[model samples]
Target: MSYLDHCSTLLFFVQHCGARGRSIGVLWFSLPSWAELELGRAPVFWKTMNGLPPTSGESLTLFYNPAASNLAPNEEFGIAFNGGFNQPIMCGGEPRVMRIKERGEADLPIYTIKIQAPKYAVSLIFSFTNGVEWDGPYKLQFQVLKKWRNKPIIFSNEGLAEELSKEGACEGAIFPDSCDHRELRN
Candidate 1:
């Protein structure tokens, strides 16, 4: 998880760690490929984590290549999730079908995807592409929680007094000379 801090914009660095357990490893230096790098930097893509930790049966929206990652006009961009491969996002009861929305900054094409998060899934894995080549096996972990009501417990003062009298804490416990169970009853 390394980043290049360029003018406050953090660019993600792809550290290809081999089968080793640790992320620290030798950097496999190589020439830049058209699909991997752009303008001396990795083609940047955007994803939203606002609806994360979503319970079962919730829809999440993800935006890809909103700013950078200049794809060729003919190149098609798509995402593959854990459940399916190269699946099209369902928008307004219809699949967007590789359509680009030019509503992003600088009129850049932003690919939107809607995911129906399942309750049984532990994590969501996503792979992206630009028609010519593919990038990423980006993972989004989930913390599944049971649906529960927010009920606060309130203890009655009279109930506390009755319980304290039954225990008589100062009898066997160490305390100051002024310590008295009667004071707690009051």
Candidate 2:
């Protein structure tokens, strides 16, 4: 099989196997850096959490691409809380959804949501929407770790409000490589 075919097969396998929230072992394969980038650009049905190991009572920035689905222009992308150990998973009394806009000047409009993680929550469950359809019941579990580590935000979850103040939405995927969940441990 050609390299692109292998990449497509791997993506299909990951998409199917990754949905159930079951952790999968990472399969290592050698590929040129350019080929890896090519594979990474293919959009996948997963959400991106700006920071790693989401903690309780902190800023959580999330991105969703409406172009990935057959969403109408009138539809608003949003998140619905599935209830959690602490009941509400939002802090600072923010709304469930922020808004949708273009990250750059060109690309599919990405839906950006910002919330303060609940201080008392141990886990979170939520889903995505394009006003007409739903995407996930994605779950996140948090642990109290003594050693602190932080992953740099791969995508800029910043300046969303200002961008919304301006006109138009982006036309493509912003961070095609960032995938947040394949599994969640209960």
Candidate 3:
């Protein structure tokens, strides 16, 4: 969970979450050093986080199950994706699918998706594009954008980081601080 100790360049990343691991295929670019995190606890509340301050260039979205976490438990969460980051976000169907590039061009050059979740439970996933990872000891946070009731945004760090109190959401994690971060040789 490199949610802390960052690492990544970022060009908009997206994830489809559910009871299991990630349902929809996860597309990611190895940032220089970074990983993403939500405002609160697990089964993050996406809509609540999206409404926060908008990241400079990247678009942050949180997709989740309205009934997955601790709420309904019957209805399913929905989210979808479109490559080239040129497609519209559609939240429907279980295990929402996103178009994928051919074998050779496996790297996701661009894309976007929307995760739809219910009010009580938190189910937010985000996609970030164009970001330079940061080294922390710095203060950042996820906030519910004042404009809307459930939108969240990562402040500062250009979506790479949000402005908030360091409550230790992801300290001592494996991501940006993974042993892989130990300067390897090719």
Choose the strongest candidate by TM-score. Answer: 2
TM-score of 1: 0.39
TM-scores for all predictions: 0.39, 0.41, 0.20
Q: Would you list the clashing residue pairs of candidate 1?
A: none
lDDT string for model 3 (141-177, tens) is: 2222233323342221222222111233112111121
- The C-alpha lDDT values of all candidates are 0.33, 0.34, 0.24
lDDT accuracy of residue 173 in candidate 3: 11
Tens-place lDDT digits, model 1, residues 63-171: 4551243333334434322222111111112122333556536444545554444333333444445434343444433333343112121222232233223453212
lDDT of 2 by residue, 36-155 (tens): 222333222222254344454444544444353333334433432222222223221222443554446565555554433433344344445434444444444443222321322221
Q: List all candidate RMSDs to the true structure.
A: 22.6, 14.5, 18.5
Determine the C-alpha RMSD for candidate 1 after optimal superposition of all C-alphas: 22.6
Error of 1 at 32 (Å): 26
* Positional deviation of residue 36's Cα in model 2 after best superposition, in angstroms: 11
The 10 consecutive residues of candidate 3 with the worst lDDT sum are 131-140
